[model samples]
Target: MRIGIVGTGFMGTTHAKGWVETPARITGFCAETVAEAAALADQYHAKAFASLAAMLPEVDVVDICTPTYLHLEQVRLAAAAGKDIICEKPLTLDVETGAEMLRVCEDAGVRLFVAHVVRYFPEYAAAKKIVADGKLGKPGTIHLRRCNYRPKKAAGNWFLDDAKSGGLLMDLSIHDFDYARWIAGEVKTVFSTTVGSMDKDAPVDYALTILTHEDGTLSHITGGWAYPAPNFQTGLDINCERGNIHFDSVASAPIRVLIREEQNAPDVGLPASPLAESPYTTELKEFYHAIAQGEAVRVTALDGLKAVQIACAARVSAAEGRPVFLEPQGGVL
Candidate 1:
């Protein structure tokens, strides 16, 4: 498969690297600024295009690594070109555009996969397997935490702007939101609170969200760029009918388990594979397989929509200071 990439920032670079490591080929890299695209292309040993339009006709898959606000337009362009899409998360800054993007892709008969990398993380994949294998024995409740310092500065300029990045929830918490959906089931309601830096003008850097699921499973997520830690920290704890499973992002062994005395402790460590191969590679391979074999993607556009819905509801809850129902005004995609 030949793929074209849009945006060459950190995330774009990560996704591009994943593609490079996959069996598929990276045909072109695009950026609004042609120079930026050219630089990334040189770095990754791929062709450079001035814009998405220039790359659309040359590739089978369009991997959108642009800002959250630009996703709708870029996805729409790719759909119009009849290329399959792999988009970075937080489908869009809002629900309307996200739903529209999904609709466009569906109508175009294009496969749309969202990069909810947590779903593909080795530890997460392991945790999912353990849960599915009945080791967790009917999940009861979950707690997820993802936090990091914004530094005295941000890694990128767009990330600091609320208009482009969707602040903290659309930018960061969506990771946990997607993971929570994968682990705990459907969300029923959400309540949230946010604390922004007094010095920043755009969006809050700190946020905490409580999600109530349909099955009475509760999920709490806290995320921010406010922590003084040197690196991002994330993890989850699932309380189940039988036992509990915990994973810490900061740990060398990211996953761990404590079952109710029946089983011995299991040490979950990151596999000793080459850096070129990771859950990101696994996910990219899945996308390639889906395209090659004409199968449904594991993480569909609708699944992506649901994740955004969850994040949006959390955003509303935070702004309103009340628990908001996770009701899709139109319906689920």
Candidate 2:
């Protein structure tokens, strides 16, 4: 399979690095400018195209790592050209646009994959496996934290634009929102509150959202763009009926899963395998093979849409200062 990347920013570079290690050939790249694409292409030993239209015919997949606002148009073009798509997260700025991207891809007879790469992270993947294997009875509560320095770029960068980037919740917090849905079942209700981000020009922002999962599980998710640059961390804590699972990026150890299946049994700590492979590479490899060989991956288009729906709902809850309820729309939301 040949892959064409459509951005040269951090995510685009990160995804490019991942794709090179996979079975797919890094055919070429195209960004807002040929100069940027050429730079990334030169480093990765691939060709660079002046436009998406020019590059479509040469690659089997279109990997979109552009900003949140550019996804709809780029995805429409890629799907119309009959190329499978790998869009970086939040799918699009809103549920309506994201759904349309899916519809366009479906009508074009191509696959639409969203990169919710957190699912492939070693620690989170391990916790999910424990829950899936039912070794911890059932997950009852989860707390997820992700924070980093606010993105900076040219004067009018879209990162801070609420209408364009969906602000912090849609752009940053949605990772844990998707992971929460992955660990538990679907979300039933969402209540959220935020600070500093509502004005769209705040120097830093923080948001806390509480999710009530359909299966009686609850997830408390916190996201921020307030940390100092080079000072970032993400951690997950899961409390289950039989035991507990925890992982902290700053923790000086592997993921610790404590199992206590019996009423009086001693708690046994099992350390998972250290993350040897980049989750980004694992994600791209799974996506590459799924496209090449028709296998199922950890994430799907519906998962992407559901996550965006939940995130959009969270934004509404925060803006309206009320709880928002969600009803799954048969299959699509």
Residue-wise C-alpha lDDT for candidate 2, range 134-230, written one tens digit per residue: 9899889999998776777656667777878898899888999999999998999999998852564567789999999988899999998787664
What's the lDDT for candidate 2? 0.86
What TM-score would each prediction reach against the true structure?
0.87, 0.90
lDDT of 1 by residue, 7-31 (tens): 8876777777678777888989998
RMSD of each: 7.3, 8.3
Best by TM-score: 2
Candidate maximizing lDDT: 2
Off by over 4 Å in 2: 197-202, 253-275, 329-332
Estimate every model's Cα lDDT from 0 to 1.
0.79, 0.86
